[model samples]
Target: MDIPVRAHIERLLDAHASDGLSEAVEQAFRAVPRHLFIPPVALACRDDGPQIIDRDADPDAWWDAVYSRASIVTQLDDGATDIRAGSGDYTCSSSAPSTVADLLQRLELAPGHRVLEIGTGTGWTAALLSHLVGAANVTSVEVDPVLGAQAASNLAASGHAPYLVVGDGALGCPERAPYDRVHVTCGIRRVPYAWIEQSRPGAVIVLPYCPGFGTDHALRLVVTPDGMAYGRFPGFASYMTMRAQRPQRDQPARTDADKHHLTTRVDPRTIGHAPAGADLAIAALTGLDSLGQADQDEDGPRYRLWVSDPAVPRSWAVAVWRPGQDEYQIYQVGDRPVWEEVVAAYFRWVGWGEPGRDRFGMTVHADGQEVWLDTPDQVIGSEARSAC
Candidate 1:
């Protein structure tokens, strides 16, 4: 409509032209006005800090932000706190234009194709999908009823009415069975078997797989003849975790005298900020998730690599790195040998030729999923905890 946010978005879509962003997909992007989907009062996430924009207070700023590359924060604390009040886990939002463009391109939608969408946040993506394929062919599911109703109104005002269901998206909309394509907006820890069961063979499912480890990835999976779906990581993605699969809050650290103490030459940053492939490898092998936190000490900068099991919250390990130190201290507080297993996994990833995210593949079936290297049979790990 309004001239499109042509430069940056076009360049991003064009770069992925070979594998994604077909002409129809680009037109669909131009067709959906992002501002219509965004709330009047929302937060625009920035690297420095989140700036709150209110349409009534400053319509100019709100319009600019909706068109900008920043993702708009629509809800905070799952709607527990007012967005203007500030400070809460980002529960929901309209994804950045770049992310929406990348994922829609990967969907490869065709006119008249049946599509099932999960997490109908703001309904912008469903509208886009409806534009690509007829609106009657699209079905969207949202977990939150309030957001679902709001999204319904937004879609109606925009002259698109895709089927909207209020239910847990992980379960999927089974009534609209045998979908031609599946598009997911939320980050998933487990690939729900229901999704595969509902889709026909050869369905293309695109989702953000956030394992709570290092960097999350965008996966493009194709359902197979035998009812299994296999795919590879196309690139990195960082979306909020699916509400159903969100991890428990970490318990306070134990200060027991029997704690294991060790020192290693490996910098904590090496493991903390490892490439996406290594993150997948280590999480799969050790059954542990990791995150790095930065701190300032008297000597300048320090890093802490936190490794913990999502299933067993009590078991954890922390590797601390200080400036100018060849040796870093590692503290293990549980029986999992969390540090040792992580070190082994780290070296194992290195031994496998230091594969990047592109070389990793995932297989999802009814029971669970597995992450493999290069091919399906060469499964590096069989845990479904990080597969979705």
Candidate 2:
């Protein structure tokens, strides 16, 4: 084992003992050089974690990005649009060690399992799988040409050549069907028909179900001969949604300047178990009281959340747009009191037992897109609609 890398793996194993994920960590360490898998010369080792070896920030000081315990983001916004500076909504990353460990533990890949990894961000995960199941049985798909080329080079240099393809992962590479294990590195709003059709019966597929949960969570599913599997979210995770599969959250504001409304901040304390804290708020409002969808407005890079609750006479905003921008406006008529109603969710959670974020359960139906929260009974679904 690589001495320096092994030390880091040992620490990680010690940190997260539940998963017993050291084997996978060691595999990542020994099989691939920490340097090559990231942007050339943009990585730095840090005591707490991996430091950003951002290439665009300083071209002259480009350093290898592969650092101990660091997950380098190879593609952001699925590499569709450039943010110029500051990483925005990390879309594709060489997933961090802790996250990788969690997924591996949940996935539990055995030897000789043919694995197809969708949304190969940096090819490191595939390389680790190569160490376990051998390169011939591993197939990885990457959407970005730039990242894919870099990943190909990294894999080639690492001496593990899996079938790496640069194309839309939404359509799982059908050329190699009947994979025993299908791992999706990217977050997806929709579980594509192509993936189910291609996998073998009883195949274990792991992917981040995106957009549904306020945050993405890993969905560990089983494949039947007919391409159907029932699985709940393994845990909360954040991954870049697949480029082709990114959900269209184009919720246009309610352009009723003449209209008025009532709104409130879903108490942060009540961020109990539900796909995401935000989703939990939405679920409670829709179920308990009469409410429709929520709306957030972006003004020159800042987002202002706008909500309307017919139950209340007044409205307010608790700020869900962007965390940093200084634009938190909380308002409610003394009588309407939206904040009080919002806090009512917290009390409800307390009454039920304060379940943390993980306890929240989700069941993806046969369609794969529709999700029910807090068991199938708490049905909270998302659809493409104008921001309202």
| Candidate 1 regions with alpha-carbon error over 4 angstroms | 1-21, 250-258, 384-388
Which candidate comes out best when scored by lDDT? 1
Give each model a TM-score.
0.92, 0.69
lDDT tens per residue, model 1, 216-245: 899999999899999999897778888998
Could you give candidate 2's per-residue lDDT for residues 267-330 as a string of tens digits? 3323322335444444334321222223455444433333333333233333333445343344
**lDDT, each prediction:** 0.86, 0.59
Task: Give Cα distance to truth, residue 298, candidate 2, Å.
Answer: 20
Candidate 2 minimal-lDDT segment of 10 residues = 284-293
